[model samples]
Target: MITRIATLAAAFVLFALPAAAQSLAPYKDDLFAYPATLSEADGGAYRVVDYREMRDVNERDEVPERRVRKQYISLGVRSQQQEMKLGTQRFVAVGTQQGASMIVLYLHGQGGSRSQGVNDFTFGGNFNRVKNLVAKAGGLYLSPDFTDFGDGGAAQIGALIEHFSAQSPGAPVIVACGSMGGMLCWKLASDPLVAERLGGLLLLGSLWDESFLKSPAYKRKVPVFFGQGSHDTVFPVEKQEAFYRKVRGKSGNYPARFVRFESGTHGTPIRMTDWREVLNWMLKS
Candidate 1:
């Protein structure tokens, strides 16, 4: 069963790569066509990487290296102290292992809870394939319940970022926000501390808010993994691509990838192996 799933995941990966490169080609000329006076290195623009190359890199033959068997262990009852509380909130840790060097914080969507996030992020006990990659590299995963909706929840998310960052000083923090969680993620990006601490951002079925996108802190070298569904009713691929173009317009060499899931809805993109692939990249790349 695992073998079959792996095969299917590889197939999906092949399909996802095309969307990464093709999504913003046409907009490049109109969006990033600056005069020769402004050099790309001077923050004008940088050549967009060919997404197909990622596929080639994955195809290379590799040694049979030892891997940490991913185990979804429960890390007991946890809660946010009143001072840091954005509102009544709690969280649960789910991953193959735990440590300080690398941490992944997944923010749930509107009305979403850790219960739903755990099952969704882990694909209901199939275990994240990337967990081994992360564990071997020394990292853990965290999923939190955002009872506070809208931008009001940003502070709580920031508090969590602060907590984890403080726990592991100098550790790279990666935030994977889905749907409404993306809103809070953007709000957190505006914060100099949170923006400085983030190693990467993953937008799953979420749109970009230009308010923070154009900020200097956000425009830094932090990588962004954008996952979108062609069939997503709330926020379609068009919106994701538009956001990508907007960001790419300002920062040419920004490490942003658009992973498209064909015929997928709002939730399906979150259920793929892509999450682990991107998470590992954010941590180990």
Candidate 2:
């Protein structure tokens, strides 16, 4: 049965990839036309852009006039004299403006920036819709660019949580990640500090290998929502199901839920919408 499911999953992946590519072609140009300048509240120079505006530009073929209500934050440490230089990390925070009810920390997939799987700086048209949805749901969205293309471990995510918590106190935090970020979420949820502050976790298209989940220190107590494409090529259905089974066995009363989208491919539109469902679940939780 597992072999049959795997073969069918492979076929679905093959069929879904090219169809997704064609659907994404129309909004490709809005990715890089973001606004060039932003003045921070602390009198610092920061570049800001509305990812939704970029998407509108892609769909309409022109940059739309809109107020710059939110700013994209770039966080990193630069080398000083006789010190090694770590590369800068880029992240976008939507709902940083007033009236945000909660704070959400987002980690993107492999080779994806802190935009949380959306490339508004390149291809536009509702690319960053999840962030906007969180904001509309009265929450602040915080995403961080991890070290080495999101290959950074739990420490990076922890640092981002601390920084955002310091910036906005008393706001409940929810952590969300996709693909490699899902692995990071798993690692972070195990930490006591993270567990103390985190209200929920959302994992999208996660690659949670069996060995990783079986580790002794990887117990997660918070509610977790996991969504994946039924046809993900990178992480097949059998592997995902095996990982889910392991997690279910290891954690007691973990409140974990899984949804598999039919005919979905890795990093495709269906995958992106699955993320939106994750955000919705987080908000309700």
Candidate 3:
């Protein structure tokens, strides 16, 4: 195991500079990046993104849900939809399986599965962009099937993190949680072991937990990115904004960010969050 880890570390060093010292190499910024930033604060950590359904969704997709074609997906990346078992936990990993310099895991919301995170053409192909970015950057992306959103599921996710992290010893693990998946994110944040492994947390159109203010991850100052839609009916945006303010108030220098998509709905963040920009910020935080 030690020899394998050493080999992975060597591979990582050759892949790119240490994650802390550099940002992710650009993938397709011209196509996948967010539109004009309406406003920003706290050194650009907090901002409002101008989101229009006509441009962000209708124009980008050839047929909305049915197809996005070459504009959104690159069929070349090695995105294996197969399952890997860690004890009893199962997951679908996209990108390099071993010797990764960075690790990203997307936890789907209620009514979503492990497949949701790896789907190339869905969610405006945001997931596909993430797959390509990590692969090109020599990293790993995981979409796991968990039992529940409570302790059991968080433990399952934590175990997966431990297993992959062992393979890529120093790789930073960033968990991007959507909607109900935020429950698991908060649970993981409260766990010291998982918290130690986390480079950051991306809450996309997700709920907030007041308890997070006292979590181990918070104490450790783990960077956090909150992307929400201003018009979200489920999990009101105002409440989320209040929470972001509290996080900032708690620590004047905490590595945290909030991106509000004006006039967007509940699923807007998943479809619109800029993976490259946010992940780079966390890696360099």
Candidate 4:
């Protein structure tokens, strides 16, 4: 009887071994094995394909071209007395200097000028990196100064957009603002008319809360790109992350991206050579 019982126990162990092995197999494969490749026969040869891998490669290779055609236009709008009290108001249009598909309205940060400083609020003398980048991306750049430190400047921009629309109907407009200008950009983005008139919104160093994002107007329209510095002293990464999380959670279908730079201040320097990357993303969006 003892011999028979021992033999039965050994048999049970053998049966259980394969089941245990099978249970662990998937975990091992997930960690170590290359994802299974799908193949299809084309003619006489089998072609192995992976759609995700292809997309990654395509995105990686995407870079904007170096050659850019630029044209400058002087845009002047009448300012109210209140606006004049804030600061000088002027609008400059920069484009391929020829036929362009999209128009980009650029707003500088606090203490920023259209002619001076890089995109990040850093003072790089005589460096208009943002304008050059926009030009390379095949989009027209329009830089406007707000009457009072970029506050209530959206009205001026709206007027300009209306005037431009009268001349050229059905042109796509994109709003790009950094820091304080971002405030105005958000305001314009929430407007129904502006939403219909504009194509997308790009905000750098934006200092707004989730309440602004919760607006139904912004949710229905406007694809936004939010870029922030991870080590930003003025705008901490935690706050940005929290705001992004809220936006993502609220709007499941919104086309919004939050990119965190490894190292930079309020405004990161926009290198002309790096315009390719910026242009590629802008054009693709």
Candidate 5:
């Protein structure tokens, strides 16, 4: 049964990759791109990025958590904030609705709502950049609100993916989970259906699951990107880095990448992650 599932998983990923070839169009390439890299390892699969609060936060935000530079946002993107009866869940949808070439979904952490992923001003306008990239590349971007970070929430997100994916057949689904939202990411990975549709998994300032080694997504070779902060207090960076190393070693060098933000804290990865760079890599892989 395991071998049969793995074969199907690989077949689905291969089918999904070709449609995701068109890379994301540039949007504030100079401003949103990652800054200087501090170090690199494992042939560039791992990197340490230079991050400073004074520059990445203070200089970018006008009121810390309230607002950001006006230039960082492009309000013209056609985004619809609505509720879907699929699971009675609320979500913010951006970019093309039908026949989308790709699909990107952001699942926010605990104490956050669907709006957090669509906030153009906060998080150094990182969310705004993703919206523009998806819109220009003929893709769909969704940020949804779920009941909790458990099986119930995973079912809600899975239903959302199935509904949108039906509208845009063969579009690769790349899920990005922040903080506690990683719980759903792992759960989705274990789900055979969701695992088959996934192009990649982005764990931003999130946790790890040991069972992932035996998950269908692992057998499918779905790419994974980990963004961590060296100084994160909520979830220690060491544990995540250790798990990342284990994943690479266990999978004989899996399609996984890690980016460590030197001196950054819990929310730094959410604010500093280069969505274009990460998404493009997964699309091509």
Candidate 6:
């Protein structure tokens, strides 16, 4: 609990500042990279494959190569003066929640509010910017208050999944969780009902406990794109690599990949990297 508080405090404090002082675009190449080869189970996990293994793999898939213009429509959340309000609901949509074919449910880190997820783009090169780009690309997006997903989080997430499924029927759902919010994601992915409708996972500086990892969800084979930093003090990079390798070593073809940021701290990678392509790949990986 102490650690959670500390991390949350750091996140908000850091986000309150502008990134122009130390933006990631300059260090883009030094901090970002994708796996050269997608792992396969051809006799040995070391086997190479020219094509990425997955149902969404499309070598021909095209993604935006530039920073997109940010767009959004405030849902239940409203901000004016120095005050923020929930209005009548516990969440807010960073983009239109209309006929989007895909929904990106961004779960913010602990002690953070739902409003911060989309409103914090002022810091630049942040999740809100990524959300804006995805939204502009015709995706439904939301970030719920941390309180909604804590004691009663699972039910809330399940309801959103159900709502999106009913709204768009076969549209895929992406749970883009960060930090403590990821705890809910692990449980959600483990659920048989939720797992079936999942498009992919965008794990940004999140952690999966040993137990959930050993559960049936571990074998779900959902395409997961991780953005983790080498200098993360909360969760070490070695553990992330081990989990990736283990998933790859699993019996089925798992489309798993990670962007190892050489010098980024825990939240820096999440805040700095160009996620348009990564998010694009997960939707169609």
Winner by lDDT: 5
Q: Which stretches of candidate 3 lie over 4 Å from their true place?
A: 1-22, 79-82
* lDDT at 47, model 5: 98
By lDDT, highest first, what's the ranking? 5, 3, 6, 1, 2, 4
What's the true lDDT of residue 154 in model 6? 71
Candidate 3 lDDT, tens digit per residue, 97-160?
A: 6667788999999998888898888788889889888777777889988999999999999988
Candidate 2 local accuracy as lDDT?
A: 0.48
Mind giving the per-residue lDDT tens digits that candidate 2 earns over 1-285? 001111111111111111000111122123323223222211221112122323333343433322211222111100000111122444555543233356677677777765433343222233344444444444556666777423365776676666656555655577777676777776766666766667667666677745445432345445566556667788775677566656655533444566554445564322233344344444444
Candidate 3 residue pairs in clash (backbone atoms < 3 Å):
none
Worst 10 residues of 4 by lDDT: 16-25
The TM-score measured for candidate 1 stands at 0.64
TM-scores, in order shown? 0.64, 0.57, 0.90, 0.58, 0.91, 0.66
CA lDDT, candidate 4, residue 209? 53
Please, what is the whole-model Cα lDDT of each candidate in the order they appear?
0.53, 0.48, 0.83, 0.47, 0.85, 0.55
| Tens digit of per-residue lDDT, candidate 5, span 149-223 | 999999999998988888788899999999999999999999999998999999999999999989999899899
Q: In model 2, what lDDT does residue 193 have?
A: 76
Measured with C-alpha atoms, the lDDT of residue 175 in candidate 1 is 85
**Can you rank all candidates by TM-score, best first?**
5, 3, 6, 1, 4, 2
Task: Please state the error at residue 36 of candidate 5 in Å.
Answer: 1.4
Q: Model 1, stretches more than 4 Å misplaced?
A: 1-88, 94-99, 120-127, 130-136
Q: Candidate 1: deviation at residue 61, Å?
A: 29
Against the true structure, candidate 2 reaches a TM-score of: 0.57
> Which structure is stronger by lDDT: 1 or 4?
1
Clashing pairs in 6: 56-284, 56-285, 57-285, 149-153
Candidate 4: tens digits of C-alpha lDDT, residues 161-182: 6655444455567677777777
Q: How many Å off is the CA of 264 in candidate 4?
A: 1.9
Candidate 5, residue 76: Cα displacement in angstroms equals 0.5
lDDT of 2 at 149: 29
